[model samples]
Target: MSCEQVTTTYINAYYEDMEKLGVRRATLEPRATEHIADIVRLVDTLLTKGMAYRVDGDVYFQVDRYPAYGRLSKRNLDDLQAGARVDVDERKRHPMDFALWKGSRPGEPSWDSPWGPGRPGWHIECSAMAMRHLGETFDIHGGGMDLIFPHHENEIAQSCGATDKEFARYWVHNGFVQINHEKMSKSLGNFFTIREIFQQSEWPDTVTGEMMRYFLLSTHYRGPLDFSDQSLKEAKSALNGFYDLFERLNESDPSHGAADQLLQEATVRTRTAFVAAMEDDLNTPNALAALQTLRGEANKALEAGLSGEMRRMVRQEFRALGVVLGLLQTDTWRFKGQVPQRASGDAESTAKTLSDEEIAVKLAARLAAKKSKNYTLADQLRAELASHGITIEDRPDGTSRWKR
Candidate 1:
């Protein structure tokens, strides 16, 4: 495929995966190639303003023109020059000066510009795209921590030099994600894709989108996340607890008595803690912990037999707080029994847990086995159902109810 086609395919797949993970779509999606005209205009402005120079159709930004170049990256020009990765190009004015536009080569995508046939440089493309969509100055710019250096620093220098205005008011750089305490790299044989994670057969329980979402948020965004099957399992188990509480709230009567002050106090405390944690640099780990504490209090209240009104109040609070973290929003009944199908592969062929109807059938057989005094068969059936995450509660009426 062509470069543009490959990029388009990747972008479409990225958006599809984000949607599956419950992330909302961005208000605007801008591609660098689509903004070529804007990029050319910015490059022309830099050239006219003497911030950039063209050599044999190749345009390079002059770092010496922008005095505050290394302010963002917090390195001096001497240090950057010492550690520069650029080749020894005597044609450039300075070693640290970077490309604003690269002269096109044969069989490469190119556009006509004042200089010649070429394409915008990597850093200039981002600056041009952002300014085109969000004006000269925007509130925030975010990227991976690795981009804080040359990429972001160059963006600042070129953008501010051209417009004589601040480019972005805030810069937010997030940390990397590691696999099992090691850097996730293809050379290391640990690189994984979202689809691969969902279709992994290492775990008995099928990994769902929600479970992956929760696993991501469980750690602080600014900290390196150590992703593993165990971490995913922990996330899934935590969500199960929340869903279990939701199920109890749904089944409990919600119209009989006054609210309990203790439970009410717990709910209020949870809200305060949740908000405070979020405000503190989006510290999701602490926020989740606050909700977990509330979950514990909620379970206690349930065991103590809360009034219907209090139960409803607690449930509403849980949902409201959970919405902020993008958790606990699925329907309680559906979430309880929902088992996402694994992607087609050997994983898909693996044995899956029984559906609710199938579980009921097994429960009925177990009941009949007990009625016939076949204690061995009844015990075997009970063990089998338990292994599939089902719990059977036998009632005094000679019937059993099953839950997951």
Candidate 2:
């Protein structure tokens, strides 16, 4: 769900995560580029108040007009100027003012605007676009902490100055992702994209999606997440053990029976612990510790040969608690098969041979049958596919795909 792609698959994944927490979905997921009209209007309003100016076909905001400019980041304006490399623009009243729109350049996207058909700058885009979707004021505005200074401060100044309304009631920022106490960077080679990490299926104890989630939430949202192969391996081991217990519970069959009173109480206690942790400004490490403690309790129950009803209750409880921390949502580890071909030089030829159209068709049929309330047909299809070592995820997007 980035700026470029807004596919139904992304929506389905979002809803899946929401369902795990039993939370209602937001009314809209507006893309910043889609709200050009709102952005243009806001920039125009800023210009009317003398808070913004147009220079070289670009609109720039007047940072000095706002007396509270440095309040958010708690830094002195003079100190900022002393440390910064101020660009001299004759049209700008002050050098600290940032651009609201950038004049069109070769190879970059552009749109029609009062500023001579240019594109909105990054900070202005969020302020205008979020206001369009969430109204002039919203309960929460969140992003990575790196955006706090200059970017968020500029957003607050522009939006509030335009609408004369409180921009956001609450501002939340997540911590950084560091590697070995050093900030991750492209030059240092510590940077790894999600796709790159997903490619490491060959190594035993290599982190999967579930383990990655656990490893990520191992630190509080306000704390730094250190990247290391050893930490990820430990997270993988922890997730594998939990999955094994879950598979066992799903396999064993028994009639409905009352779960242990203590087990039910444990469910409530675990959820309470999770909520308390999250309420304290998303302390995910404490929340994750709560999840792990519940896992231990469930393991004890399984080892004691608890009834199917008890196992089911524990399963449902864990699913609800796991979502807020963004863990235990997918079963990607089961598909730890061979890695896909890399686009070295034979990418075109490999694509022709490796595309799974036929298998995808069969999976689609099975999904269709299940959706039609044919459990018998679905079970038969699953059993048939089990022979081929392929796993299927019946997504809400009306498309079926196999992984293995």
Candidate number achieving the greatest TM-score relative to the actual structure: 1
Regions of model 1 farther than 4 Å from truth: 201-207, 254-259, 333-353, 367-377, 389-404
Across 1-404, the per-residue lDDT of candidate 2 in tens digits comes to: 55346666776766765443334676776766788898899899999998888788899888887777877778767988788775677677777888888889876778989778788887888887788777899999888998889788889989888888889899888888898988889999888755455554332223355666778778777678887777887877777666666765565545333435666677789899989998988888888778788888777665555677788777777677776655665443444333444332333333422335556566767887888989899878876665444556554455554544
- Model 2, 394: alpha-carbon shift in Å? 32
Candidate that scores best on lDDT: 1
Q: Cα RMSD to native, each candidate?
A: 3.3, 10.9
Poorest lDDT segment (10 consecutive residues) of candidate 2: 344-353
Q: Candidate 1's residue-wise lDDT over 1-404, tens digit each?
A: 87878988998999877766778889998888789999999999999999999899899999999999999889888997888775769999998888999999987878988888988888998999999999999998999988988899999999999999999998888888898788889999999888667556333322367788788898888889998877887887888888778877766454343337788998889999999999888899999999999999988877767887787788888889888877777765352355554443454344576777788788889999999999899999999988765677675567776655
Error of 2 at 366 (Å): 35
Task: Indicate the TM-score of model 2.
Answer: 0.70
Candidate 1 clashing pairs, residues 3+ apart or interchain? none
lDDT of 1 at 339: 58
Question: Looking at model 2, how many pairs of residues clash?
Answer: 0
Q: What RMSD does model 1 have?
A: 3.3
Q: Candidate 1, which ten residues in sequence have the lowest lDDT sum? A: 198-207
What does the lDDT come to for candidate 2? Answer: 0.72
